[model samples]
Target: MRALALLWGCLALRASAALTCPKEMSGFEGDTVTLRCTYESELRTHPKYWCREVGVFISRCSSKIFSGENSQDVMEGRVSIRDSPGELALVVSLRGLTLKDSGKYWCGAQRLGPDEACPVSLTVVPATAPEATAPEATAPDAAAASPPAGSSRPTTQPDSSSSAVGDPGPASSSHSSMPSVSIPTTRLLAPILVLLALLLAAGLIALSTHMLWGWRQALWAEDAQRGEKVHLPAAARREEEAPAQAPEAEETSAPCRSEEEEEEEEEEPDPAKFIAV
Candidate 1:
């Protein structure tokens, strides 16, 4: 039974070295980030070391420990280690985390009288959005309107004294009761409108350039075809005129070179009637 217990303890120690971190880790700035390292273990006095592995070097982390009363600078204050010391889970609190605090961390624990250790990966996520504030206009202006006295009204009017007179003017009462309303101007949005118009103009320009290029290409092709046709006829005419012999006279009569012409050549041999026989 004692041998069996020793074998079981050895198995548990081997299992504790297989501790791993969680798959998903997310936390906002100024929030707590828990590096979950779950493992199987039999010994509770073994100390686990958490380090940040950057590139090829491992740096020591000064965070809290689950050994009850032990804590470091990085692990002090709000920082805490899990209740189950054998589990090897760690929690680090960043009071006001900034962008520079993002990094990857790893946790490991060494066996007591042997050369064996386990490690797990950890991720630190910083906040994305900026802090919120009361919604207020960044730029406020109220000098667009002028009164009948040819002067701009003050942005804030002072409280008036008690008057012995009758009802105040409607314009005066209205202006005093209401907050100054600054009218929106087309000039304020001119840059955006101009940018939109320029984009449209650029599209039109590109389309026109494409159309003109296509038209020029078509016209060039047509001209090339016509020139080829003209050159072919001229070449044919030159070939046909290759066997030129002479420039004969322009005569209206037919040529006299056949035997029928010999009859015509020999004058009419008029013969008297053959009286004899």
Candidate 2:
């Protein structure tokens, strides 16, 4: 009997040492969620996995989404798993969850015996829409309460006709004649307009600067062309003057040579006359 009791206690202790995980988790569609599963330190070296449970009656993790052998991270599609040996835990991440992903899952570790696993129910729901803001209420205009222009106030006089009969003279309406007007706030429009104005101003400034720069460049080109034209005309005048001055120099030298020849002939005695003497 004592041996049987001891065996039962061992089984209970073994059951108590199973993997631990959250009972339920929830996430919105297109959102990501993280789950941490802890296990005994002895199972730290075992391969860890995060998988979906299949079958209605007998649920089992047949669809393994992600698994990791060591402390390295393992990723498959939108699911990822990482084992932490120091913490003796497995971290699983699910991204871009959809409504179809709402089902039971298991955090499991592979061993020689039956794999250690814990059930975790995940719920995925559609994302909620943002709440709409109410329109701002405007106060009634003061001018609307005033009487119309060119209208005189009539004086009220005591009635002398009725003595005994109670008379409710005129039913004064309590309702205001002015209609309620709702003014839409232009909170976003102001910034958009300012941005557009700034962009337009910047464009105009850029265009003006470009036009001015182009005009200056054209002016500079025209000035350079004018300078070249002026320089070419002066150089042509100098070349033409050079040929004219050369002819004048040759004519002056011809007269000087004629005078020298006449002087020399007159200075020398005639050789024929000397022979005759």
lDDT per residue (tens digit) for residues 1-277 in model 1:
9666454334423223456555434333454455556554543355554543332121233331332424332444444444355344444333443334445444445555531223333233333232222233122112211121211222322112211133224323443333322112233456778889999999999999999999999999999999999999999999877655323332323363465778875877545545543
lDDT of 1 at 43: 36
For all predicted structures, in order, the TM-scores are 0.30, 0.41
Off by over 4 Å in 1: 1-17, 57-74, 86-95, 112-277
- State candidate 2's TM-score: 0.41
Clashing residue pairs in candidate 2 are: none
Best by lDDT: 2
Instruction: State the displacement of the C-alpha of residue 141, model 2, in Å, after optimal TM-score superposition.
Output: 35
Q: Which ten residues in a row have the lowest lDDT in candidate 2?
A: 168-177
Over 39-84, each residue of candidate 2 has an lDDT whose tens digit, in order, gives 9987877777777755332334555755655577888888888988
Task: Give lDDT for model 1.
Answer: 0.43
RMSD of every candidate to native, in Å, equals 19.7, 24.8
